[model samples]
Target: MMAKYGACLLCLSASVVGSAQAESLAISALGNLDLSYTQPQRVASYEGSPLPAQVEILPGNDYWISTPENIQQVHFLVGQGQRVSKGQAIVKLTGPEVFHYLAQVEAAASLYQLAKSRYERNKPLLANGSISAEKWREISQDYFTTHLEYEHMQHFMERVHSTDAATDSLVVAAPVDGIVKLNAISGPYMAGDQLFSMVPNNSIRVKVNVPTGQSHSLSAININQCHIAIESLSAIAEGAFVTAWSSAVPQECNLLLGQQMTVVPEYQKAVYLLPKNSVFSWEQDSQVFTLSDNQLNALTVDILGSTPEQYIVASDQDLSQLQVLSQSVAAVKGIMLGLGGE
Candidate 1:
């Protein structure tokens, strides 16, 4: 069956080529091949098919809330997915570390007061030459050291919301306004253990990986058919791909953090779109036959992108103004290849 089909195609191609010089035979051959022409659609820009992308929390907008000390009992004040304000109490913690740090703050305060008083008392004595300069210097050093220690301890207590040290339990507050996410378990947690996560102001962005093969100017990109502003494109290519980031997405888009989806990328360039059947491969390059003055001429085209039934292409000649073979393309292409001694 295949050998007979090949012989028939060869005969048809030879007849078509042989009648090229005679208008009557050429017209009849063209009619028998069922050839028709179509003009390409021209556009300023074009978007390819959907490419994979991921929604990610913007850098610096993600906060990991952690415990400052070993916690025996952990209770979340805010529920998961709750919106919390800055400095709002988010967690209630109970542990021996809390009381231990509170006592340290009080002891540092007493030492600071004593050192400060001695420093003040020796100032006048040193001015009047009653106390040696070396003794006054020693007192001044003690005063500054004690003051720093007191401030350090005071700040630590304030961090855990136990500045007064009046309670055995400590309360930790949110560092910024954001949506809360729980990470802690029911059991006790060690120091620096992440208790929850916060996404500040819903600042999340979409990330796309553009292949290095794409060299045209990227004009726009859309997720779920919703246009998104491109925040940045990385200058350095990682392996075979370059990363691109979108601006903070709107809440209505309903994109979730770490969610992967399809994105359409459009390039800014004038190109022509033709039906997929109109194009054919010739000598390892894409080419289409254009009809002009009763003659069919092959023109090479640069394929930029494609759809299910159409191809986005570019050529040196303006394909928008010319008629290209749209039907019986394979038969005509085979004839052209036969004439070319292929």
Candidate 2:
């Protein structure tokens, strides 16, 4: 290293060096620096570190499955994450309450048929004045009450079907196409207890919890190197973090519901990516040394973000025409501070 800066070091050294330096200093003065230069890379966007993310179902898309009857025994026909279509059986049930309901429905059907027959047979008699009006009114009332009970039973039957009449077993079918999210084990469940839960394919989304200080205005996230556009972010904050939400992934993404994965946030903006060593602090401002006409000139820049090896920065002046010092920054700074003369 060159030791002799002499009086020039004290006279020229300044606290802050701007790009307007008129002195065309020779590079040889900063001895054995092994200096190197690099051009800043102009990019439209850059990716940050991978953040933890999870696939979740929106609250409005949750479908809860329950029955009014006490479930003494339950057998799940489908597993978690299993895709199913409407009318597909999801669980089998066998309980005293189930059988009792079936028996009651059968009895209601029989009584409805008997009432209907009597009503039809006596109608002509009433019309011809052969039967009293009071007696005809009684027949009409029986038919109406029995028919109402039978219709209610029929609707209950639609919710569950008899898988084995002798065994008193019934199967509950899915009401819509979706994937099973919460599946109950083969055990007893109280009346109205949740037996299963599901979500439609299009209702799934990616959720990411980002630190409050970082940028949250993101429109896309990368998973497994595939970029997926974000639909929105939660307006409120959860303590020190904010939640970012992504739209439903397409079939081509091959992402499964309830799957957890890392995601990289991406945004569109013009920025310059420069080497880490090329930048230095000058008067609390980030500055880089530019080489032109054999002279080193310091230029200030705004640091937007940074990685371990690169700093994502922005500058009002066009940096494309200037070459930045990529190496030997510390030695150059010491010389500029007049310390090399010691």
Candidate 3:
């Protein structure tokens, strides 16, 4: 009787083990599993391109005005950040030398007048028989000589006067309508001092610096169609044109002058976007869980491209019949049951 009981207990234990295995399989089938669908998509990506270390917005043609005076007092017109127009005065310089040149000009003019009078008087005497031929010739030559000297003096005087006037009251005008970038105050400027810099309001360009290695990637895309974001200004601007670039990444985007910005270039082909979480890795290979017939199916996916937000995958088989999950599911055991049912 004890042996019979022992045998019966063994049979019951076996039955319980089998039932547990079946229950475990059923639970795995009922558990949630992540799923994703595949579709043929055109994906676009760019290689790492070198961009400018910094970007700036500078005047296309910077202006630097200086006082043309050896020693003079300088005065500023518009202060820094002041808006100026073309031909607007910026600064003035005055000195004693300015009046000195004016005096020379006046003296030269007076001498020229005297020489003209002498020439008129001698010409009539030379033509008439009043004076001896030799005397007449001498007077005429003297008058002509004096006249030439007077003319030379007059020219020299004019130049001196003009220069003096410029020095006495130097009016530095804006070459174009722009904002003053620099301020020149409290200065006795020499002939070549930069008193102010004017940046044109309309002359603005979008600049992007691509890395030497990544320059080829930029070439593959349309630069003119690229989008740009000005971080400081919080403004969005489109690419006007690509002015210049070099193999080396410049410290600053000189064309933009010095504005720092984020640039997104337009790609040649459309990109296929998938959720970032949908991708998985197996043996260092990228894949996605595809669902078919209420079951999860494993598929090795070729990652064509990727971005910060999504990934682009490529597959040889049609994935229209499959369902892809955008989010992660709790358990993947149900996927196995779904596969068995299919």
Off by over 4 Å in 1: 1-39, 59-61, 79-88, 95-167, 185-187, 236-238, 290-296, 315-335
lDDT of each: 0.71, 0.74, 0.46
* lDDT, candidate 1, 25-121, per-residue tens: 1333455677788999888776654568998777777877676667788888888777678788878877677777567777999999999999988
Whose lDDT is greatest here?
2
Rate residue 107 of model 1 by lDDT: 92
* Quality of model 3 by C-alpha lDDT: 0.46
Poorest 10 consecutive residues by lDDT, candidate 2: 1-10
Model 3 lDDT per residue over 3-71, tens place: 001111111000111111101223235434433444433444432222333333332446554333343
| Residue pairs whose backbone atoms clash in candidate 1 | none
- For residues 69-184, write the lDDT of model 2, one tens digit per residue: 78788888888788788788888888777787678888999999999999999999998999998999999999999999899778757757445777778998876787886556
TM-score of 3: 0.43
Best by TM-score: 1
